[model samples]
Target: MPWKNQSGGPWGSGPKGPWGSGPQPAGPRPPDLEDLLRRGQDRLQQLMPGGHLSGFGIGLVALVIIVIWLFSGVFRVQSEELGIVLRFGKYVRDAQPGLNYHLPYPIETVLLPKALRVNTTSIGMTLVEDPARGNRTIMRDVPEESLMLTGDENIVDVDFTVLWRIKPNGAADYLFNIQNPEGTVKAVAESAMREVIGHSDIQPILTGARTATEQAVQQLMQKTLDHYGSGVLIQQVQMQKVNPPSQVIEAFNDVQNAKIDYERLQNEAQTYANRVVPDAKGRAAKIVQEAEGYKQQAVAEAKGQSARFLKVYDEYVKAKNVTRERIYLETMERILGHSQKLMVDGPAGQGVVPYLPLNELTPHRQTPATTGSARQSSGVTK
Candidate 1:
């Protein structure tokens, strides 16, 4: 509302006539703005206590600005995200996803990253070789990355790749939390590999058992990392190549060839023996059968002869004396048949005998011819 002057000065100044100013208004009224402000102040002082309502108006505006600043600093974290709060230069508490508030920094600061996001720390220095041959070659080892020994009391050149990522929210914050997380992973993987390989043989690391051994190393690494409170999981351990030193490359190849050849020769010899032993056994069986037949024939002949002799002896036992005299006469005839005997007359100057089979054999035995002739000569004389 415009405040007009109470003292009338010119009603029709546009007519360009300055009337005589003998009567001036009461005393020029105070400026209207000043008059209006004085009246408002007087009205508020009469109605309010301690002038609190007037002060409330000013306080309200200031409150609104502070609230705006705080709400503006209130930010949200996603389900996969984690917030690391920092107050003045010190790390404060870790926050989870959703609407959360913190004092605006330079007062307090928050660092947010996807804690659940699986970050890969590839041990790139370690790589798998040609999978088709199961041969892996590691080009450059982060030796802080991978080194191992073999069973043959020798140092081996070994390298491998590890697949890993952060797991626990609080741990990753502090793990990347600490400066280079990648370097930590590389070092841990190498140490774990050395531990595992040192306990294993070179041949297994080089060949088929490589897969299983690597898996064991990964498990061990995961456990150790978790113990360190570095929230990382070992996803996999890829076994690259176990190589002999370049100076001994030919020796390594020769060893492989010799092993293969030895196995092949052993198999071949076993096959030959399998084939030949049965044939030899068959021949031996035939010879044993022939020997058995000869034994059986000899036994049968001896049995038949024994039976015949027993029958003859039983019949002879029945006619003792008669059989004995007949047996003696038959024996003498048979003995005389193959031998020569002679006799001479007594008139021939005391009869010198040329030979007598029975008399020559024994002086104790007199021949039947000599006894019979003496008895006959005596009978004729009587």
Candidate 2:
């Protein structure tokens, strides 16, 4: 056995103890550089093939260290990622998704950003949940970002989301140019949306103009980002909430209802006019046509009558005495055509019994027998 002391060790565990001094505290101690170096040198010496190590062994050790150092530069880029290679802290080139290698870290490095992924930045609000209320999800509004001024000098609350992505060819700019890409995108989106809203009326924004506003903001954001070399593509600008402030919503709704009622009344009046005016016009046209027909008929009748009178007058003018005699005979014939009359004898009596009423002599006929009185009263007989 080796030499033993009171402490049951080879040399009584020496004054400094096995590690360095007496029993140390239980906490971890930092490594000593010089002590580690010595231990490594001793181990190296023992690992040599012979009893002593040589230059060739040192060379082999250095080669192993260099290989490990070189291996440290190798990395893998995922499918959705693009690797930006930087050399000496300056951009060099881009690497595709695969096993890629760059020189060791001090000489070269890589930045892997998800270029193929789409990202969203909200302009107006943040989402939160209320566990106390059955975990109901809600939008917690940031009034400073949400409220905007309109062209008509009215206040409106707007909530919107912007979808964007890093351009494939512009990943380097996205990484290097902008220090805070998310924050920048958010600020730009808010500014663009506010600009568009500022040029729009509050009523349209709260009603039918949401789509137009989204399109305008998207265009503005794209243009602004392109100007800033942000290398961000604006996919869409969508409005989640656009409304008049709660204080004025009721008034706005009333105005909208009134507008609708006014439009309805106008339409009804137009419809009535469309129906009644056409009917009235048709009736007026019919009356005018009837008047024209009556006028034509009266004019034609007057013309025919005048022509007949003229013809008759012409005949009368041609033979006055004969026409007068014929007219007198026709007038007497017409006056006595239906009357009962008896013939009386002239004073020169040519009949067999001139004063006798021949018809009254028959028993069937009655006659007034005042022939002498009748002869005295009658001026002439035929």
lDDT (10s digit) by residue, model 1, range 104-205: 534554555546766554442535576666676644455433445666665566656777665765543332333445667777877777788778878777
- Per-residue lDDT value at 358 in model 2: 75
lDDT of candidate 2 at residue 62, scale 0 to 100:
60
lDDT string for model 2 (1-382, tens) is 1111112332222111112123211112223335544555677889876758688766665665567557767878888888776565466888898888877645665667778899988877997898988999987888889999999999998989999999869987776566567888899999998888899888788778888889999999989998998889999988998887878889978988999999999999999999999999999999999999999999999999999778868878999888789878988999987444655555555655646667655646325676556545655345
Q: After superposing candidate 1, which stretches have Cα over 4 Å from the reference?
A: 1-68, 76-80, 86-100, 106-108, 122-147, 176-179, 312-382
The list of candidate 2 runs beyond 4 A from truth reads 1-57, 134-137, 203-208, 319-382
Estimate candidate 1's alpha-carbon lDDT, on a 0 to 1 scale.
Answer: 0.61
Worst ten in a row by lDDT for model 1? 9-18
* Clashes per candidate, residues 3 or more apart or on different chains: 3, 0
Clashes (candidate 1): 3
**Steric clash count of candidate 2:** 0
Give residue 150's lDDT in candidate 1 (0 to 100): 64
The stretch of ten residues in a row with the least summed lDDT in candidate 2 is 12-21
